[model samples]
Target: MLHLMIAIPAFARMYNVSCKMCHVAFPKLNGFGQAFADNGYVFAGKQGEIYRNLGDDRARTFKELPLAVRFTHYVAASYDGGKAMTDFQSPWSVKFLLGGAPNERINFYAYVIFEKGLPPFFEDAWIDLHGFFGLPFSLTLGQFQISDLMFMRETRLTRSDFYIYKVGPYKITYHRGALLGTPIGDFGVVNGNGLSALNGKYYDDNPSKWFFGHLPLPADFGLFGLWGEDYDTLGNYVRLYRLGLDWRGVFESFYPFFQILVGFDNDTSNLFYGGFFGVDYAPGGDGVVSLLFNYVDAPANSPYRNERLATLALRYSHYVLTNLKVFAEGEGWLFKRSLALTLGVDFAF
Candidate 1:
């Protein structure tokens, strides 16, 4: 399993507030945090005071650069074949998060990730344009995780589960053009011009591209759409177009949410659809219990054609110091029939 971490302390510094103000735990955003994000990372309270030169007619400047670092490590033991293998290893995933509003209307978020045995890469780079064209919508541009529009997989503490957001249809390659001098009726066996009649040009394939927008409606409801192209393990290319609707609200201390996404794979003419309904019960402070159900359906020719996932997780966290946190969580996946117990710590400075 890939160990991914997401914790941003820059928001705390930007808002001059405790991490609890926006997060139920280390990375899960609370109601206030969601609002802050919706506003493009501009704090509703004491905004101008957090930064310098708010009245400047020139480029916006920060009193101090908003940057934060996070490190996470865990130890685990798994059971297999009536035996247990215990290992003490460091996931050793580190993240450098940087972003904040240059001004009230514009906000940006970016992350540089370094992981064990992997070269560093820029992940989740995006700029948020709040209230686009004086409408109740926001425009986000850059490479981002489309799953975030529905369920926030980053916020979940499960290490042994696969959710619908992580599953999709298989890729299908398109024959753009036949190889030169190849028979028009023959769609097989020719390799020249770097374009094979059997297999189209695989070289110089670009990475996936994405564009999405979000609109906030009344009653804590939101709608979004995403369009992009992705490649599968077989090197087949697929185009993804998705539309989603979500509703979230807090009642007392419980946060209830529902999300549905309808996606289409244009290349293969397949349907990719899913829904996630869950509730986070945050009694208070830094402890949260989550129950979520996820269901996805894809075309028969696609991988993960009829996969369904459900997860139940319990988490507790405590601050050892102002910038250090200790947490332990246990989660189980119903379909995968797996359980994971994790004891980890997070520190930010």
Candidate 2:
């Protein structure tokens, strides 16, 4: 369970650093590495028990305990048909994330879920209120993670063509209130929400913004809007929104990506869209080979019925030894309707 092959560079040469700093993995195929105790090995030492348990020793001073934690698990097996037909199962989802930053503006985030069939939910709780002075802004409140610019592209366990509209397609699932983000250094802007629960069910995007222009890519953009209430009856849902853009580079060695999304819900005016395109080929980075294509479109008059989804995926990650990682992902769906699949492995302690 902690073999990461040979303990991932023997714990990065006993801590000299440079396993990609924390590894994004390459070459070492089959068994990739770096879970570092699922992300709370804190920098590996658990840093004095995470600063004696979430820091903050009164006198409210300097910044030191911006606690951080992450745990993600997805065990999978799937095959299902339209309207719930065929069968095959073995499912799992476990996510626990806690974040920090006690002051200098304040910040804390959360997402706790232990799922097998449902019930545990917190997909992301929030608190971000950076002092604001113009370009540096924040005001998150509760329930998070719905910033879609293709939401980090894919490869996070498997993004099953966005699960028809669930897993991500037009994700509006996490809702509770407050939004605003602006860091504008690696890109920024995540805009507002809540007027008595999305007033319409979601996407009138009182303020939604996402931008990126660097880091493994040369383009990125996202905006999720709202004009809610129409889950199953009535009208005028009329306003829903999503705009995403992504572009990846590295042509000589191959690493392409693309994403696009559009959604509209004018009650029965219905209109939704989705897209995905992927390519990853690593030659010297260890192991990575991916290909993906996705599309979603279906929603015309609406008694709530839309179809036109397509998906294809293949993934492989390797690192036979060192910090260990071995991955596999496969998915196929065509024409119209449903079908999905997933496979997983991640260990980095």
Candidate 3:
């Protein structure tokens, strides 16, 4: 899903602005885009009172019921074992999104989706309230991603993934709990569990830590170190910790980023360390090219079994319109001698 997006069109329609106002590319938040989101989806200068309905004193109202839809279709090919296989996974997914800000202080967003090979369900429904008890930080009391504090998967540039999230040690999905985000840093607690058949409501976050999970600095560098007690595959609760460093930079049309982590699982003294580096380049007003390289290694007895992965991916996206995009991608595994290719279309309105 993100390092996923708002190509929802509703935001542009609501604010009477162009999509580019918030995105360097569709789904990728620009500086102003990040600001708009940080402001609880409201304009920074004012509360946007003139844009709201007048009938609400007890509850907030929207000038319009903000809504949008996103659809993805793709054709792909990949090397499996020693042969090439074709995949016609068109209409990969369809998503219905609803998001709105009633005022400057509160905002909400969620989505329902029907994905291929998956049950239709709703996900990522959360409300964000700005300024907690007159504090400078915001409190998000709902579901979000812990990895979001670092490299957000839903808002990424490539169809491939980061080493830390995909197969390394972490997971990419929804976590239910609360988060406090400030200008310089952010800290939060989450269920420490992935979504399941019951929506994982029976689970809860371990809240005893802060400066604990993910930390990114304004200097284009980041540090992460956190510990948690959770169950292993054997259904026994165990202690685990992850530590890492990351950095990124931008130079005109080029942007590059990197992340590395070392983790110990289930009280194992042996550790696994790895990371990924990637770049995004905008060579034209409506097109972006992206490249990624990832590698990770783990101990033999560790859950990761000292597994190693080395892959490279490249992608190019062209904006057919502000809310529509077409893309193609190619990926190769260095050790496995495998390759994958995809041509896809992603559109929203």
**Best by lDDT, which number?**
3
* Rank order (by TM-score, best first): 3, 1, 2
Give the per-residue lDDT digits (tens) of candidate 2, residues 1-349: 1100112333343345555555444222211233442221334343333233435465442223332222234455555553543332233444454454333455455646666667776655666565556335545566543433234311342344444234223344344555554443222223323213344655544334332221223343333334333232232233444444545455765666565655555433556667677776766565767777877765656423455667788877665643445666767677644455445544443
The 0-to-1 C-alpha lDDT of every candidate, in the order given, reads 0.59, 0.45, 0.72
lDDT of 3 by residue, 178-292 (tens): 7776765666666666554453455543333222455556687887776666665566666667777888787898888888877776555546778899999975588899999
Candidate 1 backbone clash number: 0
Which segments of candidate 3 are over 4 A away from where they belong? 1-7, 45-50, 55-58, 168-173, 199-211, 268-270
Over all chains combined, what TM-score does candidate 1 have? 0.70
The digit string of per-residue lDDT tens for model 1 on 100-216 reads 888776777777888875878776666656554665544454435544544556565334332555554421111111111111110111111121223244522454444444455
Best candidate according to TM-score? 3
lDDT of 2 at 250: 53
Comparing 1 with 2 on TM-score, the higher-scoring candidate is 1
Alpha-carbon deviation at 280 in model 2, angstroms: 22
Q: What total of clashing residue pairs does each candidate reach?
A: 0, 45, 11
